[model samples]
Target: MLNLTLSTSSYFILGSYVHIGSLKYLYFMLTAMLYIVIFIVNISLIVVICMNRSLHEPMYLFLCSLFVNELYGSTGLFPFLLVQILSDIHTVSAPLCFLQIFCVYTYVNIEICNLAVMSYDRYLAIYCPLQYNTLMTFNKAVIFIAVIWFYSFVKFLITLSLNIRLTFCGNVINSVICHNYLVVKLACSDTRVNNIYGLFGTVLSILVPLLPIIFSYMEIFKVCFSGCKQTRQKAVSTCTPHLASLLNFSFGCCFEIIQSRFDMTSVPRLLRIILSLYFAIIQPLLNPIMFGLQMSKIRNTCKRVFCYKMLTRHKDTM
Candidate 1:
């Protein structure tokens, strides 16, 4: 049904704005508030982790990296979404759309990798305590972080390269977010190559990281079950935050991917939009809250920082 044509340039209509009819300003304000909260929470967590020397262990470093990735991912979407809400037109330039796709998807890839690494860190701490310091040293953490970012870039580049070269039949994406499959759907040319490569990238970017996390948790559970009550409680405390994050992100990803891949005309437009924006809005906002509130070390450091600032202000006023 899509007509293929040669055009100098094209813009995409974000058809996901249908639910935001008369409440544009209200929507913008609320989303802006959400974005601000996300920024504050993630930044606060990162600062808390970074400033505490005792908390510079592998788990905390990975948490900091996770927080940073959340900021990166949410930043890719929130500002743009706010602007789009204010404007009557819901179109984006070709280049900007592609850029968003790159930023957002790369954020996701890095998130999966970061969480995987965090699980591995916990595993090393619990199961291989003697080697935790030696194996997961500061330099090794940096290397893992580097690999997370680098692999995300390389995988997304390959997929985007395939997408950019395609001739598009139309410029409308029926979703709130930009991703490779949506763009490929608009292509006038055969997309078998893109689809194949996209699948490969998905497996590499998501499943590869997930495999390690699952294995680490399994090993962790085995050790916990065989240990004393204190050991079991410690393991539960350490894994609870990571598992919560994994579930939140996993659900968001599954919703978005399913929406993109299947016919969702039967679903309500508003609900679909919410589901699509879940990763951008909810996961980023939730990660810091989960980790900061639940992880005792980060929580105590945050309280100390807050108390210190408050006392400093009170003394100055007195």
Candidate 2:
């Protein structure tokens, strides 16, 4: 029988890292580069949205929030990953592990909620264009963003509090990062409350955001089908990137959930690692690229900003 009480100073061993001899350095470099790219691109878009008066609308405000969340999510994972990749000992202190859990859970919750709110914002812009200004004022947009962040933080705080009371039988985690589900599974103490709350939390997390996304898209599709070619074009142009982002993130999350909850022993280690990292790595990188390239307004603003800087620099040199 495993111990029912865990010491405060106890640490967790991450068991998922495969020894690749000198390849670990190569992996570290690639991860560092990826993090740098994610940071630069997300920051650039955030700056573009913030500095431009034209992007002061509710839609762009939502995008700014999205970009910020990408930075938050990636920072929570990448730096820790970089450290772990180089470390011969794959151990994390309990406090740090719990902290990572909080960060990651809150990030996921905020992301889903943010996307849900953005979907609703799009619905208003397309479905009620004339009334959008009244319906989703700048103040209202700020409130929505604040509420999404607050809700996610509070929700996970409760989950973390519940989890902290558990006594762990073991300290080995089977994945590359600190995961909530895997941690809960290690508890030697009774986890009925945790289990119940986790199930409830999972449902709420998914349905709360998912319902709005579905409703918003359904409404959007209705308008696209019934309305003229212009409206259809408008819907496609605005919604396509969002849809892509949402689906990509959702699929990544699904894979993560399935892998965590079920047996994946038959899956190849390399593929498992890639799929596990998909949501964290890809979404943060993809969002800025998708929105930056696909949205004409943002693309134009970026060009103008770059060109203006170059011209000013030339004048200074002369």
Instruction: Return the top candidate by TM-score.
Output: 2
**Lowest lDDT 10-mer window, candidate 1?**
1-10
Query: Tens digit of lDDT per residue, candidate 1, span 199-284?
Result: 78877876789788989999999989898898888899888988988888889989998888899889988798898778778889
Task: Give candidate 2 misplaced runs (Cα > 4 Å).
Answer: 1-9
For candidate 2, report its TM-score.
0.97
Q: Model 2: which ten-residue window has the lowest total lDDT?
A: 1-10
Per-residue lDDT for 269 in model 2? 86
Instruction: For candidate 2, give the lDDT.
Output: 0.91
| Candidate 1 global lDDT | 0.85
The Cα RMSD in angstroms, rounded to one decimal, for candidate 2 relative to the true structure is 2.7
* Error of model 1, residue 262, in angstroms: 1.4
